[model samples]
Target: MIPKYNLVLCTLLALALAACQTPWVRDAQPRAGDAAPAVAEHPTATPEPETKTTPPTPAAPEARIEPAPPPDLWTRLRAGFTLPTRLDDRRVQLHLQWFKRHPHYLSRVVERAEPYLPWILDRIEQAGVPTEIALLPIVESGFNPFAYSHGRAAGLWQFIPATGRRFGLEQNWWYDGRRDWVAATDAALAYLQANHARFDGDWLLSLAAYNAGEGNVLKAQRRNRARNRATDFWSLDLPRETEKYVPKLLALREVFTHPADYGLELPPLDPDQRLELVETGGQLDLALAAELAGLPLETLYRLNPGFNRWATPPDGPHRLVLPHGASARFSQALAELPEAQRVQWQRHRVAAGDTLIGLASQYHTTVALLQEVNQLRDHRIRQGDHLLIPTARESLERYSLSAGQRKLALQNRKRAGNRQVHVVRAGDSFWDLARRYKVGVRELAGWNSMAPTDTLRVGQKLVVWTQTPAAANPNIALQRVRYRVRQGDSLARISQRFKVSIRDLEQWNDLDRRRYLQPGQVLTLYVDVTRQAGNG
Candidate 1:
């Protein structure tokens, strides 16, 4: 369809053409009312019926229009790839062989990369960088936006907290911008570009610096200089991970650039049909946003993985990514919604005897959910204070899992949610039970109405909640303090002094009440200091 301005321009052009096609008569100078050159008017043509009985069919229009084909993201990525034709080609082949041995790994990573690969390629193209850079996430995070490593690297780029913040990605209680596709991509590319320049345009060295820090790369380079050795990426002594990191990216690029050669199929995707960004002016619950957009909450979370909770941050940078074709519907629906109604909200003034648990119980939510939504570090709330409460979605399982998540979740899920009772056997400690059941010690204690430090009796039936982790109470310190029995100290006197029960002391020390106390006899007393007075 023609745009309005274009349609108007077309109309003007047609009118100009019609004016050009007008029949004209030559002007003649009239001496005295000489017969003014009369312009000949063309008469409309009417075809006379022929003697033949058959009538002719009408001709087709002068112009035939067909809809343009949608741009294919995979095709663009293939074309835009920074093809390796030098020594790196051998490295790429090496990676290809490694991939051939472990083909499923590549397939899984590719499946995970499907959502963001197109967008990453587009960003690389826009930045005029080597499209090979697009494959970096495969090595760093497998393109899993929620991917976090034990090394503390996170998101698709696998940026650690310091590096993430260095690139201006937000890290906070409610949100982490490292998981934000848009912000993280921009920051990552900017860092890549800056480092690429820092290493004097050697992308290999730059990539190494990205994997290891610039300081490490510089140290490697300095060592090479001192040894009078070649300063190429291969020659430098770098971290084991960084050494293979750049090669992995290049190898992945080769496979992606020629998927068929590697016996792999690149997933098909439309550039315009990929995920789209929607601006949220303020805090909006993802559950409500999903409902309005007709999306599963899991899908919303996948698209907006930066959100650490059920909703966006109370502060700004409020945005949500929606699947393609849903943005318009969501935007329209959102426009119609009053700001107050965007997410289900309840405003309650803190009354006497109000606690986070009590308020959460009254509102049908969890203390953790309330704390997360309101950025509360503790359950403490004052009287006459107002609290914004968010209604929680029943479960995260209601939403679909991303390709990577499904695999990991399936593996871990095998041990979770069995809901079986464990009859305590002799020598079974809470830690032992927790390790056996793959549950937390504190959770085991909570389920069985005990404590992590509590002694377990033989043949006791313990209820286990496998699906949930023990919610840690940061304010409560479960510490075992050493106490020595004085000459006058009795079990009751020791218990009174430490605010611990005599029964607990007997269990902890494995002593009978009949045993006499001796001077300087050491005993372990588990005390929750926070529950006592004069504690912070």
Candidate 2:
């Protein structure tokens, strides 16, 4: 019985050890049929990325970025049109090549003239023309306001005088709207609009017409059409200058459009550069306007390109352009200058190839007088330069009975110490002349002795002034200085000591004092530096 008990105990111990070794048998486990319920929230769990199932390839990262928005409908439509930007060398070489020789002309233009980019851009945009067209000026006249083509085109926009007049541009001796910034801008825009309408809104053709005239462009188109060739500017056989004219404008446009692409650094335009057009009823000074408006004088000069002088005329509707913020002040100040001081004036912008003399001829003023009044010491006024001019008044009444109006006036005036005469131009008449010269018809007749029925011929000179032209005889006189004689000098010794003439000493010095011959007596002498240098 004891042996059986020991065997049973050992068996029981062995069973316990086996149960310990297989712990899975005692612990709870998840069965496939009874899996643990999934939790709704778990701190340690991470969600999968909510993106495209497959990522983009390494080669095209940009593919993931959205492309730039398409240009608006207007932009797309405008892109179809192109204006003259530059000359096509193969199609036309003469004028284009000739102008290219003066490559620095453009740079010089930008330097002297106030930047018209702001005002010009605004006006072009207003006319529905692209801002790119502003660059067309570089090709037209190299941005010269006074550029005159062999074809008779003038102004920055190259409007012919007649065409400029047709567009209501003023063409008087006092003012040529062709050179007036505001008026020329309006005329050019109108002409361009007309050309565009005539060409059915084909800007390129309109531009071509503008350069070569509508008649020439129409002829070219008809010729090309008859030959079954394209009517595009590229195919038309335009004049040499006209052919390259478009291309030159395009080259400038290309440069302006993507300056960075061409490695050119264009300063970003300032917002303040924008201008607002306002009319003036009377004269105003630019300096005063600039001060009232808190603007720089250079800025005013740029903003108002019409005034050819420093002061705006007080005459009716002088048409002054003030800064964006100063129109009110300008008008108020215009009311302040004396009414008599208010002279009729028109503004003119300086153009390339223009000199003080050329401007004087245009305005009917002497260059010397222009310089004298404007305080200009130099002859280098530039394109886009502005000037103020005092309108010419009519001649005096006494000069109406003379035969050779100019000669009679001059003779009468020379007899009366009159000195200068100016020729009557295309738009001059007795009334305009009288007002311009500030003389009545009778005074003019008395001055020049002109007959009442004698019509002034083109290029015929008329007496303009009663004073002898100072320019005719310059005031070239020596300066005189007086000095007191000292105790140690004799008359001959004093003459030799100061290197002066005895005769001049006698003439300049007091003879009575010389007779007194006292020490420390004052003596006067004339020393002509020019004469002294000549003697030396």
Candidate 3:
């Protein structure tokens, strides 16, 4: 039978053409008087139908778009589909066997990962990286942001510390970007893009470089050239990790796209969900902001994973991106807070020539309170010191006292709740546990009904604290002072030196009512000094 396309084309050619423009047309002519000569119009063409009824043999149906031949099993096993320049050659077959063998592991990974796909994909696209790379986290981390590899690579991308830093990821006490979806996604994409360019735009080589490094890929290229062979990632010897990286990525790509073909079921994704970033200048306390914005602390923490401390940097200009809807309320709440209140918590990184005294004076705080909040044991601080200043309406000293008293008031804060028990590990100490739970050492002991002398042991399962409603920290007691009198100092001189009256010195230090100065003599004096005394 004639093909439908041929019939449609033939029918089109036989239609009337007078209504449509042709290659040539006559110009208008005007005749004198009332007579005008007219040109003859052409007859419309019609398709001719033959009387014969014999059917024409059908041409072989156009070949279906065949899948590219699987690369030589060994080669395809080595090289797989890449994000750029290629889309069809995938390595799904190899992982199917492994997936079959480890069904439960895959299931658990899927279970844990079902929620994050949309977020991850959004970040991946934000960096202009292929969305397919999003599947890689499933293989590398089971989509756990906090996942770490034995090689010390971390985060969702499993970047090593050096690489993470190179990508602008901050590694500090409070945060690891390997777990920061936003920061890590940005850094990882930048690294991948750089590697892609460096390796001549071969994505397979770039993948190998990402798992290893560009330097290794360069060395391998040299080796292949030395041997005069095709210098590609598959032709070069690579590390074990790099060797599996490409295959695993391609296998993941297949699982994500044709999940059921591999007997896998992926959770549904909200393809349009994405986060919006709001730039918040200056360091802001995330917890405080969360409270002000009516956001849950954990939710904000999850969204702004880059903040290593409870607060953002005190230095000018910091940005926090809210998940879609949270920014408006956060911005409004932030604006409502007194400027002075925000300044009070502003963080300052000690620059050269900065001192605790200078900072205290500038912020209208006492040096002692600054040191207390910052836990500075020395009066001298070097450059690049980070200090949390209390610059708000309340002085650090007052805040400290209030916090301490507040904790004491929370004596019944902890009601019966599900308890979380943890065993101490090696290098674990009381101080560590106290800080971890944001409790004081004494309070921790009290909560567990333990004596101060109770020792912690590795592997000892002990209740750390009863779950309690969050309250301010307890007040720290200042140590009392007992002064010893020195030689060659008269009672009057001693009183002047201690900023106390001679009469009070005599009464408190128990000086003789009628004592004369003497060399090598010692007298007792009470040292009830305030922060002002140090300044004086």
Query: Would you list the C-alpha lDDT of every candidate in the order shown?
Result: 0.71, 0.57, 0.58
Instruction: Predict model 2's lDDT versus the native.
Output: 0.57
Scored against the true structure, residue 428 in model 2 reaches a CA lDDT of 57
Can you write out model 3's per-residue Cα lDDT over 30-108, one digit (the tens) per residue? 3235466674343333334787464553333343577886333223212433454322434335555677666677667
**Model 3 Cα shift for residue 193 (angstroms):** 1.5
RMSD of each: 15.4, 22.6, 17.3
Q: Candidate 1: where are CA atoms >4 Å away?
A: 1-71, 83-93, 347-388, 393-412, 415-536
TM-score attained by model 3: 0.49
Local accuracy of candidate 1 as per-residue lDDT tens digits, 1-536: 65687667666665654554333411223434458566543232223368646434333333446989866776677677663444345665677798878777888888887777777787899999888888888888877887766456778998888899999999875678888877899999999889989998888888888889999999999999999999988789898888778777877776777777777876666556678888888888777888889987777888778876556776757778887789999988888889877657778898654567557656645677778877789766767888888754434444334222333353343344644455444466988777866777766665543447656763345666565333342212445466666788789987777676787667565566885776766665666566655522
**Each model's TM-score?**
0.62, 0.46, 0.49
Task: Show where candidate 2 strays beyond 4 Å.
Answer: 1-114, 146-152, 261-263, 283-302, 307-316, 325-332, 335-536
Worst lDDT run of 10 residues, candidate 1, spans: 21-30
Worst 10 residues of 2 by lDDT: 396-405
> What order do candidates take by lDDT, descending?
1, 3, 2
Per-residue lDDT value at 484 in model 2: 68
Q: Residue 371 of model 1: what lDDT?
A: 83
Could you tell which candidate, 1 or 2, scores higher by TM-score? 1
